[model samples]
Target: MTTSSMKRSQPFRSLVNRLLDHGILPTRKLILLLAGGSVAAALGALAGLGYALFWLYNAFLLLASILDWRSMPRRGQVNVARILPEQTDIGRELTVSLVLENHSGQPVPYRLRDDLPFSFERPPDVAGVLSAKREIVTYVTKGSERGLYTFSHLYLRCQGRLGLWEKQAKLAYEQHIKVYPDLSTVRGYLQSLQESLIVDGKKFLLKTRSGTEFHAIREYVPDDDPRYINWSASARGRRLMTNEYRPEQGKVLTILLDCGRMMGVELDGRTKLDLSMEAALTLAAVALRQGDQVALLAYSHEIKTYVPPGRGLGHLHTLIEAVYDLQSDFVESNPLLALEYLHRQQKRRSLMVLFSDMENYLLEDQLGAYLWRLRRSHLLLLLSLADPLLHDWSRTAASNSRIAYVKALAQRFQLDRKAFQQKMTGAGIQVLDIPADQLTLTVVNSYLEIKSREAL
Candidate 1:
C-alpha cells in the first residue's frame, strides 16, 4: 500500500484499552496457576521429589501463560474516523463508513458498532483484523420516513495479546444528513422544459393566436379566437384554417396532496404518497416557470400544511420544502375541511390539481356537494394513482374459479372508478386516472393544453 494509506490503517484500541474492553482472563489464569504451584509446594514437604517436580511444572505453566499474554496486543489507541454522504433519498438505504487506522505498529483485531439514531435499521456487527494499515468498515440504514438524522459515536472492541483480555473505546464522530423526497423527478422535467423553452427554443413555446389580435396562421379548431379566418387558405387546403392563440400565463395553480392512510399503499417500490409528491413537485415546477402563482396544501383529517400562492422559479424550493418531509396519516382525509381551510386562506380562483386515491372518495353523493363547491371557486383536475395490480388481474388468464373471481373483482373496481369520473365530469370537473409513472407527462401536457385552449 502507499505510505499515506498505510498511515491511515491503525488499530482502533490500545492493549491497555483492550484489557478494559474485555476481561483480563489471561492474567487471572496465570494467578490461578501460581496458586496451583503453592499447593504443589505444600505437597512437596509431605511427599518427596515427585511433589517438588509438580510445583516446578506449575511454575513453568504460569510462566508460559505470562509470556503468551505479553505476546498479545497491549498499548495503543484505535485511530478511527467516520465518513458520510452529503444527502440521501427518503425511504432509501444509505451506507455509513468508518476508517480504522492501526497505529500500534502491528495488526489489530476489532469488533465495531456505531451508536445509530432512531428510525435506522441497526447495521450488522463489524469484525475484522486491521492489518498494520488503514481499513474501512461500513453499515447500511434505511430511513423509514424523512427528515434529518445524525450519527454521533462508535464503540470498538479488540482482544489483547492473550486470548483472555480485550479493550474497547468510544470514538466520537459527528455527522448530519437529510432524507429528502425524490427531487430528481422534478429536476429532470425542468431540464427538458428549459432546453425547449427558455434557452434557445422560444419558437417551440410561443403559439399563434387565432383572434382579432392576428397571431400566426395555423390549422383551426372550434374556438372563440377565430374572428378572421382566411377564406383563400380554406379554399386552397379545402379545410378549416385559423390562427393559434398565444400561450396563456399569470394564472393560479394549487395542488391538494392527500396524506391519508390509503396513500401509504406501496407501488413500484414507493408509497402512494411518494408518487403523489413526485407528481406535485413536477407540476409546481412547470406552473412556476409559466409565471403562474402556485400553492400547495397537504391534508389528512385536517390541514397539514398550506403554502400561499407564489410565482417565479424560486418558489419551487418553497413548495419542495413544504412537502419534503410529509408522510401518510393513518386516517381518511377530510376534503371538505381542507376546502374550508383553503378558502379561508385564499379566495382567488385557481387551477386546483389534487393527487389522491379514488377509493378514498367512493361516497360520491356525500362528497359531491363539497367537490361542487370547490369546482365553483376553482377549476379542478382530480388525479389518482392507478392500481396496476388490478390491470394485471384484468388481463390474466382465469383458469380456475378463484382466478375468475379475482378478475371479476378487479373489473368491478375499474367500473366504479369510471362511474366516479363520469359523475365528476358531468359536473364540469376534470379527472385524470393514470399510473404513477405516467403522471408527470400526463399532468404537464394537460396543463399546457388547458393554457393553449384558454380553458382556465
Candidate 2:
C-alpha cells in the first residue's frame, strides 16, 4: 500500500513505528517528578547515601516515564480533520476548525499546530483534552496575499495518561483555500446608489438629451430640454409635456487590467495592480447591476485572462474567480496586443476602460494613434494611479540642489501628464489620473456619466 494508504488503514502499526522511531518528550509533570527526586536524593545525602539514592530514584523515574509513554493511545486510535473556508477576501479573518475524533476508549490530551502558508498570520497553538467521541478546536487567521493557499500536515502531540510524556504524530490533512481582493466598497456603492434614487419619495430621473429610448411623458419643467417636448401629448393635455428617457441598458463595458512590471510597485501597502483589481471588480459589479454586459482582459507581456462580456450579478463571481490569483508579470505589458485581441473578440461598440500606468503609456508614442482609432467605434477611457509621492515632491520647496532637481523632475512629469490628458481629450479619449483610494468611486462615476451621455 502507499504511504498515505498505510497511514489510513494501519494507523496502529504506524503508531508502533512512530513509537520506535520518535523520541518521547518530557512534560512539565515529568520535570516536576525529576525535581522531587533530586530533593529526595539531597535528603538521602544527609543520611550519607546521596549517590546511591540518586541512582535508585533515577531508575524509578525512567521506568515510570517509559510506562507513561506506552500508555498513550496509538495514532490509529485518533483521527483529525481540518475545516477551512473555500474562499475569503484578503485581510479578512476566517475561522479554522480542527475536528478530532478519539476512539481509544479514554480521554486524550492533545496539542495541535497546523502547517499553514507563511504568508498568513501565525495561528495560535491549540491544546485541549478530548474526553468525548468528538472534539472541535477553532482559531482565527487571515491571509495577506491574494492566491490559492494550502494547508497540509497537522502536527499533533498527545500526552500520556500519567502526564509524564508526549507522543508526537503528523496527520496528513490537506485543504485548499482561495483569497480574493477586498471588495468591501462594492456594497456601499450599491447602497449609496439606491439611496440617491429615493429623495423625498420621488425617484430622481436621470435626465439626458442623449438618451434615445422613450420612457414616460411628464409635465414640462422650467429646465426640461426643449428638444424632448412631446407636441402631441402637450396638445392633447392642453399643457406643456416633455418626454422622458432612461439610459440604455444591456450596454457593453470592457475592463482592461494591466499586470506589467510597473504595476507591481507598492503604494500604501497595496500594489498598483491590487488597487486596480479592486476597482475593476467594483466597476464590473456596478455595470452588471445596471443590466450591462461586462468583459475583462488582464494582460502583461501576453494576455493572462479574457472573460467575454456577460450579464447578471453572477458574472461578477466569474470575473473574481478568473483574476483572484493573477499576479503582476516581470515583463512589460503590450496594450496594443490586448486591444487588438479585444477588438476581434468584441465587435460591438463598447465602453473600454484601461487601468494601467501613465508613464508606460507615455513611453509608447504609437499607442495614442491606436487608442484614437479605437475611439472611432468605442468609448475609450484611460485610468492611471497617480502616485502621491510625486505630487508631494512637486509641491516641496527647493531646500537643496538635490531637492530642486527632484522637484523639477516631478513638475516636468506632471506637465507631461497634463499635456497627454489634453491631447487625448482633443482626440475624444477620456483620461483620469486619480489616487488609488479614489479609483473605484471615480471609475464608477465616470461610467455612469458616460451612460447618461450615451457616449457608447
Candidate 3:
C-alpha cells in the first residue's frame, strides 16, 4: 500500500517542482527564512543557548512553511470591459469607459493599467478605484486619421495583504472604434449657407447643363430659353417668360494625402500628415452632404489606400476604412509618380486637393517641374499645415540665447514657407497655409468658396 501511495504522489511532486522552477512558488522567501534560522542557531550555540535557538529555528520554519502554503493559490481573477464610442471626430475629446470586475469569492485588490493605442493615452495622474466592479472613465482627443482602431488589452497587478509580491496578468477584451474626420465646422458652415440662401429669396434653381440633379425653376430674364417658355403659363399670363433652373447636384472633389517623410513633422500633438488627413476628410464629408461625389487617396512612397469617388452614406464608411492605418514613410514623396498614379486611376477630370508641405528650395529645383505637369491635367488646390509653435516663437521677444536661436530658426522657416507659397501661386496653383486647429475649417471654407464660384 505504501509503494502504491508513493507512485501516485510522484506526479504531484513533479508538478510542484515545475511550478517552483517558474518562480511561481515562494521559494526565495522560504529560503531566506531558513537561512536566518540557521544563522540564529549557530550564534546561539556559540553563546551556549542551545534550547532557545532550537525553539527559534522550529518556529521560523513553521512560519515560513505556513506563509508559502497560503500563497500557493491565486487570489482572484479580474475581467475588464471597455465601452468605446462608435464614431468620433478629430480634435474632439472622446470618452471611453472601462469596467473592472473581480471574479474570486474573496475580496481582491488590484491595480490596473489600461493599454490605449499609440495615438491615445490617459492624461497624467489618473487612477482607478478598487471595488468588486468599478467603472473608470478616461478621455483622449481623436487623431486626424480616419479609420477603425482596436483596443484590447488591460494590464493588471494584484497583491495580497502581505504586499511583498504581486500577481500580474493581462485582461483582454476586443473593441472596435471608428474615428471620423473633423466635420463640425464644415457641416455648420454648409447648414448656415443653405439657410442664408433660403432666407435671401434667391430661388433655388438647377441648371440642366451643369449639375446632375434638377432644382426648382424661376422666371427667366435675358437670354431666356425659348423652348422652356411654358405655353400654358403664357396663356394665363400677359407675356411669356422662359423658365430658368440651376444645377442641384455638386461637383466631385478628391483629396490626395501625402504620407511621406516631409509630412511627418510634429505639430501640436500630432503629425502634419495627420492634420492634412483630417482636413481632407472634413472636406469629403461636406462635399458628400452637398450632393457631391468624394474620394480619398493616401500615398507615400507608394499608394497606401484609395477610395473611388462615390456618393451617399456608404461612401463615408468606405473612405474611413481605407485611410485609417496610413503611416508616414521616411522616403521622399515622388509627386510625379503620385500624380501619374492618380491620373491613371482617375480618368475623369476632378478638383484635386493635395495636402503636402512644399519645401521651397527642394521644389524650386525638382518639384517645380512636376507641379507644372500635375496642374495641366487636374484642377489642383494645395493646402499645408503651418506649425503654430514656430509662429509663436517668431512673434515672441527673445529673452535668452536659446530663445534667440529658436526665433532665428523660426524666422528662416517662415521665410521659406512664404517664398514657397508665392512660387506655387505664381505657377497658377491655389494654396492655403492653415494652422493645425483651423485646418479643417479653412479647407472646408475653401471648398465652399470654390463651389460658389463654380470653379470645378
Top candidate by lDDT:
2
Model 2, span 273-344: residue lDDT tens? 999999899889878877899999999989999999999988988999999999999998899999999999
In the range 1-456, model 1's lDDT, one tens digit per residue, is 898765665454355455554434433545676667767776876676666667577767867666655655553556778888867777678887889887667676677888777877787888888886788888788776666778888777765554444455666787877777877666665677342433222223333351123346667677634666777788899987865445556689889999999899999778999888887887888788767899999999989999999989899988877888788998888777777787788788888888888887775356777888777788888889899999999888999999999999999999999988898899999888898877777777777767777777
Q: How close is every model to the real structure, measured as TM-score?
A: 0.69, 0.85, 0.64
State in Å the error of residue 193, model 1: 6.2
**Weakest ten-residue segment in model 2 by summed lDDT:** 198-207
Per-candidate RMSD, Å: 11.2, 5.7, 9.4
Go through the candidates in order and give the clash count of each.
27, 0, 6
Winner on lDDT (1 vs 3):
1
Highest-TM-score candidate: 2
